[model samples]
Target: MDLQKPAVEPQQPEGCLVVAIRMPVRIVVLVLVVPVRMVWDGLVVVGRFLGDAVLRPLGRALLWLGRVLLVWPLVGLWRYVVVPVGWVLGRLGWVLVVVPVVFLHRYLLAPAGRALVWLARGVGAGLAWAYARVLTPVGHAVLWLVRYLVVVPACWVYEWILAPVGRALAWGARGVGRLLGLLVSGVGVAVYWITRVLLVLPALALWRWVLVPVGRVLAVVAREVGDALGHAWRIAGHLSRAVGRFLATLFRWIFVEPVRWVYRTVLAPLAHVVRDVVLRPAAEAARAVGRTARQALAAARETVRQTRADVRRALFGEPRERDAVPRREPRPLGARTLDSSTTALTKLTKD
Candidate 1:
């Protein structure tokens, strides 16, 4: 056995030429796309910052200004001016046009229409009387006269003189129709065969023997070309993404890491110092001032209470002995009452 040749032919997904073209093309595409992706990423970052930090607040301010400047004034005008004007116009319309139209329809047009309808009914009654009493008898006499003078002779002529001649003519018509049908059928058959032989057979043979095979070949070529383009695009996309990842890593190392380090080492300490040295002292001072004011208020309250007691002692001649009040009370069996304030939270009123 000669081992030089294989038993089966090897198949490859694509040719060597396609691979040769695809690799360099992918590299070129990656090179071209890296800068564009970087720009897109930077723009995305900028747009996010602007939208979150600047544009959103600006948009809110503009919306508030628009409401204040345009919307509120318009709403006030519509409510205070336009609404009253419209109500006045509606009342005027009801008084002037609608009332007059209603009056005309109710008082004038309704009676006129009713009178005209009644007159029409009287005329119709007169016509009905003429038809029932006078026209009916005259119509019957006229019908009898017409039957003898015109209709009876016409009917007799149709039955005897004209019917037999019509029947013969109808029989001739049937015979002529059959002959014409036969001639047309024969001509139709010949034309059908002639058309089939000249046009249909050739067209069918060309479609079956020539055009179908050519279409199949063209379809296969188009499918392969489309598949090749798809594979190239997919490979290019992978390469471009890889290049973009590499660029992102490079940018992070070169720019973001140093910025983060600076913020952590430098700016964070400054912020902490400001908080501890300035903000904390200011907050503590505010609390101290609040405590002084609260003490002053408590002293004033105690002074007022003592003054009220002194006044009572001076006017009402010495204080009486205090009475002990019970904290809890008993209720009747199966009877319950609801109160606004809880006895545990507030002092209950004595009866």
Candidate 2:
């Protein structure tokens, strides 16, 4: 995409200063950049782990909680309560306001508008009739009189006297214009050639012979400098990455392996022993005690209930029974929805 760059980048010509400066500068930059890059990598790992394990799920749960606590309730309020209320209000407004407005428009305003339209039509028609009867004939007479008194005489004078003079003047002006145009065109051609020889050719020669080659050389130098900087930065990145890998390996050997060994060989067995021997027996004893306590409390509750019943019986003897009441049925045994004698009688012995 970069027109200055070839499809395959060739090795650039390095000057003495570039060769002298490259090694020391890279070494210094590497020393300065290594610690920063390692710290940046560590932060990146920690950030990714935290985002994956903690922040992502926390954010999703918070989003769901917000929808439950805030969004759903508001949506329900708008859907169920607000929508119904608005619909009812709209109906009420139509009944109370719009109905009357429509009735007034149809019954009162419509007739008034029609009356005004009819009156306007009548006035327009009267005006049209008056214009046709009075103004048209008067305008025709005035036009005829003006044509005889002024227009006819003016036209005759223009045709007979002024026409000949205008033709002679036009012929004279045409000859003068043609002579001047020829002189001006000759002068323009001479001026154009003189300026071209004096200015344009010299400028063109300077651009073609002098500036182009120098510009091309400068462009090549600038492009080479850019490529050199890019190449140096890429090499430095590779060196920095190698240094980071070495540091990681050293840290693993010096600290991580030793800690992992200690955890596996020492703490793991001790934790298992504590779980199997001491903590498990203590938990079982606690659970047994809780079961015994619950049983005792339940038995005490039963004894108290029996004692309370005996005391109530000693005080109140027995309750009385209620007297029986008769049931009230709605209809007689033979009654129905369609009663007899409601329909027409049939023959007594029909087969």
Candidate 3:
């Protein structure tokens, strides 16, 4: 029963965390923090003393030299050597420090900067050259082409368009000429036929069939007409005499008596009054107006002449030629007709 009781006994806590918190190693670990801090502080003090002993004197010397002179030789030495050495170290410093850095800057960085500068210059120069040579010339050529091809051709087409009107006019003139020719030919034919029928044939027929009788009748009619004309002449002479006497009586009654009376009584005094009061003043006024108008016209003419002279002086260096009359020769009648027509006329006259 004690064995069974041992097997069934209630256990105390058995976790690894719980067992370690109470162990002896946990106490030793807690005792290690003090010595670790003392060791870390000792190492920091050693590093500070070493840095001050080495760098502080050098920094003070540099500061003293910089205060004394603008040109610091040590600074130059530091820059030329130290910075390059640091850069080499960062790039995994090898056997040759300066040579690799110089080669890298020369072949890579300097060449890259020079190439970028050259490319920018080339682009700028090419753009300027293109603007001056190619682009400007192309723009001028396009403008010239537009003027010559578009504007000039338009003007030429406008001028050529008038050709249609000229052609129409020519066609109209030809049509009118043809119509006139046809009309003239028809009129000439009609006149020729009418002359042949009415004048030539009738004259010939009368001469052949009835010329003697017609001559006798014409002589009798002439004698009768002469007698009738003689009687009419005598009657006309008497009527003219009667009309002249009647007109003379009418003139004496309507005009002559009244004109004579007025001429004696009113005309004499009115003529004197007009001569004194109206005519003399009117003549004087007319003369003054004429003189004023003449003066004004002369002044205007002088002003016009001066203006014309000024215009001529401004426009042309010399005066224009005046009264350039052309001489002409009289044409002879012989030259007025064709030689053939002249020869025919001469032959007809001679014959």
TM-score-better candidate, 2 vs 3: 2
lDDT of 1 by residue, 39-112 (tens): 66567768999999999999999999999999999999999999999999999999999999999999999999
Please identify model 1 stretches exceeding 4 Å from their true place: 1-77, 226-237, 271-351
Which pairs clash (backbone N, Cα, C closer than 3 Å) in model 2? none
Clashing pairs in 1: none
Distance from true position, residue 220, model 3, in Å? 1.1
Clashes of each: 0, 0, 0
lDDT for position 18 in model 3 = 39
Best by TM-score, which number? Answer: 2
Q: Write the per-residue lDDT of candidate 3 for residues 273-337, one digit (tens) a residue.
A: 99999999999999999999999999999999999999989988887689968878776555454
Task: Look at candidate 1 and tell me the lDDT of residue 262.
Answer: 95
Off by over 4 Å in 2: 1-85, 142-198, 233-237, 247-263, 313-351
Q: What is each predicted model's overall lDDT from 0 to 1?
A: 0.83, 0.82, 0.75
Comparing 2 and 3 by lDDT, which wins? 2
TM-score of each: 0.56, 0.62, 0.17
